[model samples]
Target: MNKKAIWAIIGLMSAAVIGVVVLQMDLIRTAVKVNEERFEKNVFAALNTVVRRLEAEENREVFQHSINGFVTAYYEEHDNTGEGKPEFTLDYSGEDGRPMLSPKLSHSSLLDELMAEFANPCTCSQCMARKDNTYRSLMVYFQQNTREFPLEQRIKLQHINGVLKQELGNRGIDTDFNYGVFSREKKSFIIVDGHYVVEDAQPKEILPGYRNIYNSRYKVDLFPEDMPSPGLLMIHFPARTSFVWRSLWLNFLGSIFFTTIILFSFAYTIHVIFRQKKLSEMKTDFIN
Candidate 1:
């Protein structure tokens, strides 16, 4: 083959190799992007689940406290010892004169009635006004009695940590994470990583070691129903980027290995072709 044809073949092969490498790199980039997106989605979902569970737990505690208080008050008002049957009762007579049945007005019955009323409040003007007042009073009582507890007392660090770990693990994310509970009322992080932070530092200053905690966009309100300023539950994974890339490392290495092999093979083939052409020229000259 002439030098021009040999050079042309070399250029074509080089271009083909370059194109293959570009396509491979693009494929690796696309895979990395998809992995990162999936990781982010799972993290967000886990955070949401943790927030909901925390809210539910707090609500349950508050309602349980209120129910206990209501029961205590009912017994005290009825002048009955809690050990015996309730003294409050009402008599009813049948028109056929069979026998009169006595209905007991226990605290349980009263609670049932309240629940029924709450589920279906009367819409009449007078009834609505009364119901509104009752609702306000009940809410006030709950706030004063249950919701007024300090943030640390309201939620335990172990519980928060455990819930986060469980939820994240459930979604196949087992990375090391840092978390902080930012109190909107206090305008600072009240708790971080199973410890109460009493330094009163701003959330941005709380986790100096893990700067990503404050910068993280993965946060949810601690209790959305809490009026005005529900606290924030923030989470950050230090190894998130590495974790996302972990699954693609094999593919990346494989691409590099194969591309290197192809380039090596092309260079060897070109060298052989040139050497064979030179040997043929020498043979022809010797024969002539």
Candidate 2:
């Protein structure tokens, strides 16, 4: 082939290969993204399943009604201040008892112990102290509109934590996660702080020297659509930037290998074309 034809062929081949590589890369990225999203949803689904069971648990209502009865009675009795909190709620201290304050009961009070077993539990980054009443009680305000049941039952903590631990163990999913239940009607106030990280089955750590992308936040509504949602459930899963990087490295190496072959072939073709042109020139000079 002549030089011009050789160049044209190289151009066309490079363009085709580039197009295919770009398309393939795009497809690969899209596939990874979809899988990541699905994986997150599955995690949420598993957690949600646990929560639903807890919510529907027969004893759950038993506990909620108990809290309701306790708080309602306290509110009715303590409403000497015409504008105290209409709803019965337990907050960190008398501080949370603002204008709408209800009866402030200590965690260890006889009534609190007899009824809700309120105790100020120790607080931590990973978990809330249910005993200390740090967990707010918003059940009284949006009682009708909310789909939430009381999380004041201390036993429910183990149940909730157990679900997460069970799922991590069963699925063999290596992920560090923290989950929280938030009330939308209550201005996104947390109904149950489910931020416990299962220590034994911690998620695979991000590979060193790789960016940590495990800070992704995902929220899935607890209540079903067309139904009133008292709150939402949110989970944070550490991103697998290391795993993603491994895949990217392979892709980069593959692209380099492929492009190297095409470039070598194109160079050889050009060399041949130039040699042929030189041979033709020699023949013409001999005839002249």
Candidate 3:
């Protein structure tokens, strides 16, 4: 083997290595991309589930408050004696043949009608979902106090974050997550944080409320513009970017070992060929 042939082999091997490296890099990128897309899809679905549940819960709370108010009002008018619980009878002789509590005020009738309207009936797929008003209206009759409760309730930041953590678990997303609520009205500040966080999710300039947790590209809007304190819900996934590398670490190591062996054996073969050619040339010169 001459020097020229040796140099040519080295060039060919280098080109082959570079080509394989380029291809491998692209393949890794593609795999990561596909994984990310699937992750986002799952996150979106999970978010939809949570939003639906929130809506249903809000309706239920409203209905309960309404019935409580109605019952308290009715008792104030009817209760002449300071009795613990009042006993009342309803007549079922109305046009609808339904039980009626004193047709004079017809307040009970209105309550019954409201209960009937909100009652869950359908067994279909859509009805079974949280979007459907599948819960029967809860009725409580005869309460002492008639005071109205506050219109707005503070959102539980911790509970919501915990639910999101559970949501990811149920969907088999193993990566860490963090949530932050941002408000533009209060001088563009973060008022609250969902406590599900990891160390990597923190931004360099620490905000007022949020802690560094998981970092992800998924951001959801919580309560939107309907609430008195409207804000944006940010969900982060810190480990998502390195998932492919972690999962395929063994395969990458094996590839490196295999490549090293192949290159070393090739180099040894070239060395042996050069030595034999040198010995043959010296023998020919001595015989001549």
Where model 1 places Cα greater than 4 Å from the true spot, the runs are: 80-147, 201-207, 284-288
Residue range 159-226, candidate 3, lDDT tens digits: 56666677777887877655565442332324335432232334454443343422335655554424
Best by lDDT: 1
Error of 3 at 246 (Å): 2.4
User: What's the TM-score of each model vs. the native?
Assistant: 0.76, 0.47, 0.60
The per-prediction tally of clashing pairs is 0, 12, 7
The 0-to-1 C-alpha lDDT of every candidate, in the order given, reads 0.75, 0.52, 0.54
Candidate 3, residue 114: the lDDT equals 47
Q: For candidate 2, what is the lDDT? A: 0.52
Taking all chains together, the TM-score of candidate 3 against the true structure is 0.60
lDDT of 1 by residue, 1-288 (tens): 888999999999999999999999999999999998898899889888888787668765675667667557766765565454453322224343221113356544544554565577568875565455545655565566656676667787888889999999999998888888877767777788988877544444544654577779888877665575458888988888889989899999999999999999999999999999999899999999
Q: Write the per-residue lDDT of candidate 2 for residues 199-247, one digit (tens) a residue.
A: 2233244323221222235565554431565455556555545534445
Name the runs in model 3 displaced over 4 angstroms: 1-13, 74-154, 187-216, 225-229
Q: Superposing all C-alpha atoms, what RMSD in Å does each candidate have to the true structure?
A: 8.0, 15.6, 8.4
Model 2 TM-score, 2 decimals: 0.47
